[model samples]
Target: MFDYIIKNTSLPEVGVKNTIQLLNDACTIPFISRYRKEATGNLDEVQIGEIVKFKEQFETLEKRKATILKALEEQGVLTPELQQKVESAPDQTILEDLYLPYKKSRKTKADTAREQCLEPLAKIIMSQKTNDLESVAHRYIKGDLNSVDDALEGARHIIAEWINERTDVRNNIRYQLERFATITTKVVKKREAEDEAQKFRDYFDWSESLSHIPSHRLLAILRAENESFIRVKIEIDDDRALDKIFQRIIKSNNACSDQIEIAIKDAYKRLLLPSLSNEALQNAKEKADEAAITVFAKNLKQLLLGSPLGEKRVLAIDPGFRTGCKVVCLDAQGQLKHNETIYPHPPKNDSTGAIKKISTLAEAYKIEAIAIGNGTASRETEALIRRIRFKNDIQVFVVSEAGASIYSASKIARDEFPNYDVTVRGAVSIGRRLQDPLAELVKIDAKSIGIGQYQHDVDQTKLKTQLDTVVESCVNAVGVNLNTASKSLLSYVSGIGPKLAENIVNYRDEHGAFSSRTELKNVPRLGDKAFEQGSAFLRIKDAQNPLDDSAVHPESYHIVKSIAKNEGKRVSELIGNSSILKSIDLKVYCTDSTGLPTLQEIVKELEKPGLDIREQAKVFTFNQNIKTINDVQEGQLLPGIVNNITNFGAFVDIGIKESGLIHISNLSDGFVSDVNAHISLHEQVIVKVLEVDIPRKRIQLKLHK
Candidate 1:
């Protein structure tokens, strides 16, 4: 099944062959791609993902052919030639075409003609030898065929059914439709005045070549058609299709040939066109689905790998207007130290009291930074925090609060903090996201993270599979801390699942901290296979052996120990000693099981053991003078952070509740194709306001060069 994937996906043969074995053994993609780099020839998550996807498709194609062959055998219609054809068919479309003639159907003209014993007459006319059409029809007009016209019609019905069932005819017509069809949509007359329909006004009357239509446009048109707001269809020139049909079926242009032409027209109009149209549409949709999923996966990867403000004593705020703002202080390890509420805005504007409380908390906790949720009353809360005269310097960040609410109300959150209310849990999540995005974001569902478009409308199963693969890749890339990581975060690690993760956490709680990577085997249900797949990506700080604190897997400890012994230094001294690592030849330790790729990674790990792959978070502030859209004038430049991205543009949050759009056309001086390729989620940039519409809550902006 993976033969097609290996040849097409550009991965080395041995790598794909070995990786398939690991995948068969239930190892995850992240584990194979990261820990088993030698087995995959250093193929990253994208190639691995493609291989898995194509392998599944190939299996499905094979299964469908099996079912069809079984049905044919049961019907007593299976022959040596037909069985060979069915078994050799490559794709589902062609396989189904082969099965069409044998499929049972409702009563039709062809069935009636066969029952009347006029099949022999139909066969005679199809030979196209005699030009006497009326004479040929007269022979079958005795019994069920009442007259010459009835005989001719019944014969034509058989001819038409024969034409419809020909594999060549259906394939040729489908080729024409796929190459030359145009998709057109128009608003339904009765639904034009509907308020819900107004959202699709731009597609009220739209027409475009199917080949040239973009994914976003196609999905939008499909959504509109599904809602009954528009009538959508695909069309090809009728004469062009007729020319292809005539070339394939008609033999001569005499009187009898006219009857053949009539059958051709009836077959196409009654059967071929509708079937090919549906096939063309299905192909277009699959293309569109793959495109949308690609965009979504890229955006999700960026969000998961966003910058982190590492391990800080911080203050978090989930600000609101009517309800008082929820405030919480977290220690360096993200443990909740204190919680309170302050009314700093609107009706109960306790500015003086809020300022005093904030300053006192900052001094007492030795807060290094402030993480304020980017939500209602956020900007106002930021202003109040800035005004307070703290005894120590603090960096202020506006963290995206997209899925904090969902996490706060989750079962995991309740389990983690049983006594805290949702508000306090929400604030803690905001602070923790700044400290480490990959660790915190994994707790909530990736779909709720606000990065993808039309997520709910795409194939839910495919979406979940793709997103899960991405999350797993990100988690394993940045190794986890065995003692400090949460159950949700640990569950995403290479081989550990929810149940294994719970056991690990329970073991830690019962048996104090893990002092070495070797201790993972002591946990129940974690065998040698689990340890091999996961131990490399699990880091233990201050472990008994220095290699345990690095990404060098336990299986390779002997090799690292050998290098250290050759250098006449302890393993601890070899770690972070670039001078010593530079002199050793890694090729000396290479074996078939431990190739150059694995050895190279080991040397790199020695140089910088247990390093975080992500960058440190930077503090950003919106224009203080422009708190809302009403205060913004055209052409004013302001600082902002990218909040959401789509096919057309990226939305930049400018400190108010609403964000502004930076369309693809305005991203640069030259033409841009994909917005995500140029920028990313949570990226900070400067922009100049293009236009603002308070009525629609829309603001247009262009990037400041």
Candidate 2:
């Protein structure tokens, strides 16, 4: 396993060994990356995650090898050479190929021929030493075989099966596919006229190198095929494939060689192409799934780690057209103080009454910010709110309404607000999202957050696993407040899962707020292991022990205290004293367990303990001239925020119904390999409209330098 990870990743063998051991010990990724830096050789979460991935892959491969070996032994074919081959198989594909001939299944042509005693005839023809093939085949003409031709055909079937079972033939075909396979599609004639089929029109006549197709395009084509709108075909040069097989199998120039050549062609078509082509396609699909999942995970991480507005009283509005904008006021802690409706749009366009209500509520609640949902009347709502002259300054923000409804209708939302409707809950979510994106966004599904590309078409299980990892990483990266964090947020902490998170919340409700990190031991089922893994990621504000509120683990509190004593100051006085921290030698503090890495991290933490790694959320304004796609034009410069990113491009929400796409080529003057490097989620930038198709509601943009 260590060698496999070392070969696959750039990590050293020792680092891989230690990381696997830590994972085997049930250490969470965030905990190991942050707290056990010394043991992991200062490996970050991603590098440790690579070790975990390769470790699981190696374990899976070993389990598969065991299963194959057991099956071979049961079949009475586990010879020394075969056992060695099976045991030495490095991956699942190779192991499966080794066991293919012995695998039991329903009857096939080859099986019937073998049952008819044609194996001897197959071997006779396969040798290609005899020119009188007809004479040799005549002896097998009995029972199921009525004539010489029938005997010869049955022998050919057996020969084809033998050739298909040869590992070299399959590997050669796989090599051909890996290098030369092309994916092509044609419209399903019957379904081509259907309304739903038009969505995949771009794919009807598409052809691309299977290995080079972008993950999004491949997934889209596969989706089209799944939807019955297109017939997808994976193709390679048949002549080239046959020639390669011929080179390996056709040894002589005779009637026997001719028979073997026929068998090789049959094997190539009937057995080899279908099975291996499908394998190649499956391999491609898995790759596409992995790439798409990576994109989704990155987007989810960025969205979760978006800048926070922090603890501020906020007035939130879930904008609407006719139902009236649902308004809610939240205190600094994101607790709802009041809820109501304001008719600021549509037939009930009582702008005067709406503005007056907003003004009065802002002053009454001491609102520090106004959050307007970027949905149906978002622009009008923002316009209406901006018209108001409040007594105190309030920064106004347009928050994405994606998944707000899902969160509002969730059980978590219902439990928090039993009397309020989904609208009120949704408004409160928007407000809280502005306050802390990581905290509030965790309540909703990551997919529904509208940051993924082809998320639905990818492998759902893989996508979920990766997104969960990202959420966990982000949640732990920004330490959760033990006293005030929601259950959803706490559930993602290092060792605390759903059950323990709920237990902690229940315990907190029963016994007020926690005074120290050690109090986590009192929560039910939060054992020593759980506390050790989780306590560092759970911060306590204004705790009795200052280290409890910082990222310094309780196990390391003595280290910090020792440093403070060496400095001739109290722990509190030493905290945030960067001058003293810089002057201290980290090497002097290194012990058998702790190393220079952990000591350096400790000193860095003492300098700015529990400080947010994210920037403060800032107010952004959209161009007031554009309220709809009709108002947009080519070559118009508009301020936009990057709302989504794909390998091909980044989509920017330009304050209109249609979000403009900045193609990867347009992202930079040189080459752009990664979209995230050029732009990130929710990054505000100026964009120039290069093209706009009003009929399709499509807009093309270029990054304004």
Candidate 3:
């Protein structure tokens, strides 16, 4: 199974085998990738992730085969040949087709005929050598078999069942479905007049080949069908399906052959077409689900790893329309210092009071930046902030408040701020996000982040797993600050879980701050294994040993000390000194346990200790003159920021409530297969408005040089 899986996966056999062993030994992906590079042959997080995926798939397939074998034995049909076939099945679909012939079901036409002693007649007719089929069927015209036609009908039912059970027939039908299947949808006539159904108007009469339909379209059509707003089906040409089945079953054209023909047609409409069609639909839906999840995972990874502004005192606002804006002042460490509300927009229209409050907060808390929520009245709030004159230079930014409300009402938020309201928690979140995106975003559910396409329709379990993988990768890539990091961020560290994370936080609160990474062992339940796996990715600034603050693992501390002594310098002298680092021989440090890959990363980490892999978050403002969609004119180039990314394109915010879509076709002059290849989340780019539909509230944009 491992060999089979590795053949399809990107990992080599040795790497996959060693990684599987490491995972079986209870190692996390990030831990193995960073710490066990030699054992895994330098496989990164992505390859490790694939190994985990294929491992689960093979386990599931094996488990399914076991159940089928047990059921066949219980049914007294466990022949050596059948058992061998089941045990050696390659995948779930093939295993199922092999099991279909003996599967138990409710009493069908075939079962009735078998109970009436017509099995011999079905057999004779199947041979297609009998000259008198009616005469043969006449003898069976007793109890439940009235006329020759009745007896022959029952025999046909049995023969149809036999044809349906044949592996070749089913496989041929499946092959046809794979090549020529089409998905068609039609609106439910009664539901078409309902207001709720209008959202799916574009899919009311849609038809497309299942082989090439886009994932977004398939998900949308399925959503409509799930809502009972439309009927969707997978189909292929009926003649093609019948012909394929005929080539496998019908062997003659005599009276018995005519009977076989009748059975084949019955087998198709009753047993084959419906089954294969459903299988095709399910297969397509699963493929669509996987594609959607991949897109979502990519978007999430980009969003979570977005640039951070580092430590700065910030004032954040959760903008509102009628209730004014909720504002909070956060210190450099994102600790809330004060909260207040200011009305700069209508109905109160107290611009003077709002401007005075803003200027006062900026000076009072020494706020260096301002973050306003990109929600209702966001543009108005931005305009108001631009007009305010501060004593010192302060940059203003608009942050997406997609999941602010959810996070505000969460238990984590409540625990963080027991005395403050949800609105205050929300405002502080925006400010903190500007300072450290991964730290702040980890506190909210990935589903509510607004970076998904049809997230709810995809498999929730798979989505959660994929999103968690992304978050873990991002958190480990940017080593966590042990002393000041939040519990949410620490939970995503290599070996630390939610319980251990909370324990670490409690210990920090009681002991003040973590002076060294070794102090993690003092925390309850943080054993040796956890420390070994997690310490390399957990940093403590200004620690006693400089290695604790670097990505250098504690297990390798002796190696570094030996080298430092040999060079007649302290270990601290070699840290981040590229001149000295380039002079050291990495090969001399390799051991039976450590190899070149591990030694190489050690050298790189020393060059830049505790480096943040992400770019620096910059202050971006949309076109100052263009404030709304109405102001957008076709062919006018404007500076914009890519806010959300999808497989089809990216949505760019051009100082408007509705972001403009930059379709993939316009991403480049040449063909573009992936949107992320050209654009990224939160990237700054110039775009020209291609089209605007005010009534529908849509904006189309194209990339500009």
Candidate 4:
């Protein structure tokens, strides 16, 4: 099905069937090559992910075809030929064409013409080989069509309306417009408008590759257009496009080529061009949406996997003024150890007391790190920490508390800390977030993460749906710890919801800790379907069924036990032995019910049992000496951490609050196609400082030669 779409549709090669299979199987690029070995010939994740997206689009098109067919059939217009056309429609644009006449619309010129009793004349002109357009005009020149010229004009109007009404013509024109259109944005001259769109100043003369324009930029241009501060037009060469369509129509009707030419030109100028241009712009917007979602997903992944300070006790401070500074200490597992308030910044201004209290807590709890919220008087708090000169080894870092307040006021926070004050809860969350970002972050809304670009500008429902999917995929991809996971984390599990997740937690609390994943079924409301979806993803470190600790689904237990028996060992003994497992002939296990594909996966998981699928969270220690951009010099090779890898670039951490951008072009001295090929997530690479802009907080770095 996917192959047929790829061959017939305008979808690129990157969007293919095999690629989607690799992605759907969750086989890592390295694993796919090392294990599957034969399948895919080892295409990497990047390649596979692209293909998967393409396959999804193909499937979407198929669904749309079915919908169009049903709607047309309901209207009694679905002829055999029309049905075939609908089924074979190559893309969404064409599929929409098959539905357009039946599609709901307000009021149209063709409808108006039909209402005015000019349907027959319109139909004759649409046939194109009119015996005489003048004669046809003469026939309709009675009521509304007054004179010969008026009748001819009305006939031209009717023909244009009919041409536009044909779904095929509209679809063709839309495609042509998208292929040839340029998004031309021009400033409305400050004096002409209120200039409320100052953010779009750079876009005043911008003309982007219509297919590749980023969503944020597209939204900005649209906002400018909406506010009337900029006039944005989707310009296409109408004459050239009309000529191409006319060539097709004229070839079909050779005798009326001249009349058809006039009609085609009139259709484009009066009807087709305007409507199709709007459709093309909408197509451009959808393209932008896809790209934006891709970028946002990548960034969200990076943010979710951002280096966790690891499981270490932390002291967090919410720097403040009149109310003083709130201080909270959390243990290695993020449990609140203590809480207090010290007058640090203004009003009370007890800097000495703050320093003494922080140092005492650091020494007493042996706090591994101190997280100071980057809010009001954060710098002053950091300065106070520096002045204390603690005897114990403690690291102090300034953390962004973007959503700390939101979490503080949230019901979840209140539930987590029923006894503590909201401000103290906020401070504790800030501290714990640095320790285990995924765990702490799951407690808060994803939108508050501040990683998205123009997140507010996109369709809120769609944005939420897309972001929620990303979060769910990320959560499931990295199996959750059943004992430690919060309800928010559990809620994200497939087929699980807030109510069920809460029930699971309450059940755990009411009873003892669940020794096995199967026990989840015993929990109220967690039925067979929910268990099937959630069980494979939830991990218990030392469960009764060892398979629960690993990704091996329960349904594959019989196959695993048979393999164990064949090896002359118990199932538990074969859990983590790679040598014995690799020697077993996988062909022996392959059967009709258990195919080679699934059996191979089961064998691999058994060899390295209970492996955490998530990329290991790294602990990064910043070089405090290199606080400012000016502290670094050109040609100085410094050790930096790879923070993210995108198609266009990689962001590297150079011990500063802001990460430096290492564009793909600057990644290496050799030809590099992908940023991932050159660097990976959390990779420690040596980089040379290329340039720094302190004002903009931007740094440019090049990987060391």
**How do these models rank on TM-score, best leading?**
2, 3, 1, 4
lDDT (Cα, tens digit) per residue for candidate 3, span 262-281:
89999999999898899888
TM-score of each: 0.96, 0.99, 0.98, 0.79
Q: For model 3, give the RMSD to the true fold.
A: 1.3
The TM-score of candidate 4 is 0.79
lDDT of each: 0.87, 0.92, 0.89, 0.72
Model 3, position 6, has a per-residue lDDT of: 87
**Candidate 1 regions with alpha-carbon error over 4 angstroms:** 105-109, 142-145
lDDT of 1: 0.87
Off-target runs (Cα >4 Å) in candidate 3 are: none
- The Cα error of candidate 4 at residue 614, in Å, is 5.1
The best candidate in terms of lDDT: 2
What is the RMSD, in Å, between candidate 2 and the native fold over all Cα? 1.0
Query: Model 2 off-target regions past 4 Å?
Result: none
Candidate topping TM-score: 2
- Provide the lowest-lDDT 10-residue window in model 1: 1-10
Q: List per-candidate RMSD values in Å.
A: 2.0, 1.0, 1.3, 5.6
Error of 3 at 192 (Å): 2.0
Report the lDDT tens digits of candidate 2 across residue range 469-497: 99999999899999999999999999999
